[model samples]
Target: PVAAASIGQVYKAVLRADASPTGERMTVAVKCQRPNILETVTLDLLTIRGVVDFFCTVPGEGNKKLRQDAQGLLAVLDLAATRFLEELDYLQEAANGARFEREMNAVPVMRDVVKVPSVLLDYSSRYVITQEWVEGVKLTDLEGDPKYANEEGAALRADVVRKLLNAYMVQFLETGFLHADPHPGNFLIQPDGRLCIMDYGMMTEILPDQRLAFVEYMAHLTAGQYSKTLDDLVTLGFVSEELAKDPAKREVVGPVLAQTLSALYAEGGGLDKKVEILDQQAQSRIGEIGDKLEELSKEYPITLPPYFILILRAFGTLEGLGLSTNSDFAILEECFPYIARRLLSDDSPRMRSALRTFIYGGGDRLNVAKVEDLTRGFGSFTNAMEAERKVAVTGEGSLAVRSSATPSGQLDAATKELLELMFAPEGNYVQELIIEEAVRAVDSLSRDALVQVWQRLPGAPPGAL
Candidate 1:
């Protein structure tokens, strides 16, 4: 078998030249659905539903709200089951693969770095899918492979992970179509160093507004703004809007949610260590919070949206892979550049507001330190600015411009792309921010100069200035 999954097993094969679309023999993986999987899955879901229904039928006043919460869970389970059933349809999987390829190619950076196998729709059916064979190993196996044990291999691992993370960000924030199953086995690292994503059976879609809210949510969470993060949670359909609006419920939910996420984003640990920490907390502080939320839900009706479950599963699996690839991996850290790019490029009013909030502190003061940190890792930031400056002054070729005072730097294609976005006509918002800061600084200097001159005047009263 080429591969095995819960509902199917894949077998390797070579299509006959006469039957192949290319008119040449081609290697392929034929995935066949397991016999009786549909009936088995349906029965399993019914069993689970019966158990829940049993609880809902119990006689008690408290069971009333419990029934409501259970119904919500059942609804989500039904949605998930529907998605699982669709996976048995190889035709849909073929379409998903095609769509994924199209969307990834639309992003300039991803076009070359990511690879998706072509689906042979002619030979595919409801039970079997024939796809182009990818010659690669599971992404997690890279760490243990002898070829990747050296410094160069380490760099390769990091680069591939970064690209994969950015691709997922584009899927969630830009395309709104997400490849929901992101377990280690779903990704393969080709010998040529390109990443091949597989198994598009489980997928989800985020609405336009939900994607924007997700971006806003990530921005606020990364900024350590817990209150705003909680607000975004409601917007993204995690917490109930009614509970979020009530100041009393907000008081209870806000701290608990922040504490849970704080453990998730806590410093000094990779994803593995963070999981351990969360497990420990689940027995103590978080364990207690869980009990409190359960009681609170009786009256407030807290709920989880089905899409949130898929998003969590996708990111959680990715974070695990990041941990395996790099010991210092942190999802927020790896996700920052992509998030910043979105904030810089999106022209919506909400995005503009978020950009300002991220770059400016209270009293409308520019956070220069934060801005520098954000752009410091951008390889072409200094090079692009310097090259443009010299070209403007000497009317020379930008590429030929270099300085002995600065180290030699090559242009980074990704940063160069982001620079275009930041300098575009729609990017005047960023320019306005810089101008505001410069004006504020000049005004402050002039006031200080006047005060100094007044204080130094002859016969000036003590502290009069």
Candidate 2:
């Protein structure tokens, strides 16, 4: 059999005659350890530790003292790495697989979206996983295929994403057990359209209280409550209280959070209306935001809880797969309503608590008035500002403009600073003053140079930025 993976080679095989209960033929996926897998694992662990040390230390300010401190930090990290590697026994992995199986069995959504392969435990040893074989096409194989890029394809992809998200939500919120790996290759789209998830070697669990906090954070984010979203993030342990309290950090994270919320909400609208245009744009914007968030993770040093990281990576992978199958599929939109419904259901105590909080906070008092305002004013301000910015930046005038008229370029200083930060070359921020100086230098340059600087900046439009 041909090798199906790098770390482990998968083979299609029949169940051993002695193991077959009914003398029925059954295909199984046999995963064998790659040559020198222990060595590879050690190297990978070392690499990861090195990266963590670099991010946790590397000087942001000039001082040999800081460098010496960083060296000490790296020394600690090396010790931690040594301990971690020492404990990387196959027995640990087997224990993890057992835990994953137990968790999956406890979750209802897992029964629908995930396939925990039937393990031949007696035949399987550590470093090898033998499970029932699943016959299906790889999600990646459907990418760019005309058959999967039309309306039908969009619907199918959206449905898959919806199921995937729901599964993760359930695992993260309800059971607190989640699949840590959800890459496209790990998923199989059956002819019946059922999604088969494979691999359980990597999984994480969240506490029930943590899961509730996560739900609240996501709800605030989707509703465009920027401050509340940040607050929820801190409460949920996604961001530290110190970071949230920092005015500059808050200013930076707030708008970015709002933009993310807008994009998510817009995607929901697209899914509701079945608007391909909005869906595609939302997905693209989300991809861009994901990239920015990765950068932000480095600067802010926010240590994401393992369970949250699993869900984030899963959702991101699902989004990418959805895009590949149908660029117009509004995955977030399809998933949001499901998540909202789940969150608001009578069964969830967490949702009930949030509802009570809202009602007690005068939400019920202003429900009607707030509804009207949202219906009338939602997106209007942001959209108008975005339109104006586009016109100013592109020098394009709509019908009632004189050719010689110059639109006054107005942008908040904070916004300008953010743009400058986004445009700065990676790892080039020597100091806080350097960023301001760079922005000022660019501002003083020729119009063409300024335009070049703006073009080089990494961000979306004001609406999606």
Candidate 3:
């Protein structure tokens, strides 16, 4: 046996040719469910329900009530219990793995680097799952192992981590089907240099509207609009409308959220600097951020929705990986390009609504600076993707040969898309805003300023201005 957990143990085995999916003898990993795990899980759940019932009905000192808290925790626990029970059925896990493989292959950026092992359904059962054996070290072990601690090793780890992060981004922003168990234990760095994602027992699906709300959440958070950030969270089913609308709770919760989330912006300048300022303000009187959160949970009823919990778990695990690999790694810096690409490229009406909200959420005024940032981010992301495609087509070993130059073809396509959006009937308001902003800029320029601009143009005649 190679690995054992609470519910299962994995063994190395050689499958017979008749049982193999390819009709050839091959080594495989057989994961067998623990004996009588269902009864054990049932007992544990019953005990938990009893405790939950007790707390929900019982009152504490000073007549402190816990019904609201218990109710919220119960909802999350029920969802978790359902997933855990599903894990006992190995066939369900196999189905989850197959679906994940299909989704990962659907993304061009991930198809080459990420993979899911194929399941041998003929050998698999409700109690046993058989999959093709893969040889590699756990991703966590690669960071500090002597064989992978040198310069080359560092480069490989960095590349692998970037690809892994991109895979998670695709799951969150595009696919909506996310692997909730994203810890280091579930990922292996194969000898052939591909990331093997294992253990699909705990997967979650986000509704399309929820995914769009999350995209908007990232946009608002990056812009340092905490109030709108709260609104996005509400739309995401994180915060109850009653709790979010309460003026007193907002006064306390807003700053705490800012402090916790701004930790992602601990690098770079400009917008990052602004985020740092907000963090500093929020941390003025903190005993500890965790303590504050605990106190808030006691003071208010904060529900942990299943999807929201899974999202946080995945992101937190990824952030931990980033920090372990590089002391100076900033999660937001690594994640913003993905968010920007989605914002610019996704043409669904919900996404278009999100983009408009991002631009005008602050007030009636047009946020020209925000629009400029979006375009710049999109261009950089497009250039990087183009470089990656070229490298993949050429069968290059790494990104060392990737070019730093912009790809004009992608930019031209983006420009065309923007033009179509601008002239479309639904975009009339945006068109008016753009023209008004342009005329305002020109009207504000002095004759001397106009002359300077004209003289700076290519092939301008001397004294033409």
Better of 1 and 3 by TM-score: 1
The TM-score, computed over Cα atoms with residue i paired to residue i, of candidate 3 is: 0.76
Off by over 4 Å in 2: 21-25, 47-102, 108-113, 144-150, 242-307, 325-332, 346-349, 357-362, 366-465
Best by TM-score: 1
Residue-pair clashes per candidate: 0, 1, 0
Candidate 2, residues 1-465: lDDT per residue as tens digits? 644765667788887566764367667877777678778878887787676566556555655445554554565556545534433443444556566666666654344335555666665776666677776666666545577766766665655555566566566667776776777677776544445667666666677777777667655554555677788878776687887888866766776566655655445333444345435544775556555556665556555543355567666666665555455555545355444444333235556555434323324232433233322221222232234334434645321211222357965433443455445655322233345556766766766665666666787243321
lDDT of 1 at 412: 54
Q: Which ten residues in a row have the lowest lDDT in candidate 3?
A: 397-406
Tens-digit lDDT track of model 3 for 1-465? 899888999999997888666789899999999899999998999899788867766665653546776766777788888888888889999999889889888887667667689887778899999889988778767765797767777766766666678778888878888998887878886655567899988888888888888888888787777777887878876777877888877776787777656764635334455566666755576435546556777665555676677778887788777766676677777777778778766767766666676777657666778888777766555555555555555565342323536456544434544677578776544566577777867776777688888899999999985
The per-residue C-alpha lDDT of model 1 at residue 448 equals 93
Query: In order, what lDDT does every prediction score?
Result: 0.74, 0.56, 0.74
Q: Output the lDDT of residue 145, model 3.
A: 78
How many times do residue backbones clash in model 1?
A: 0
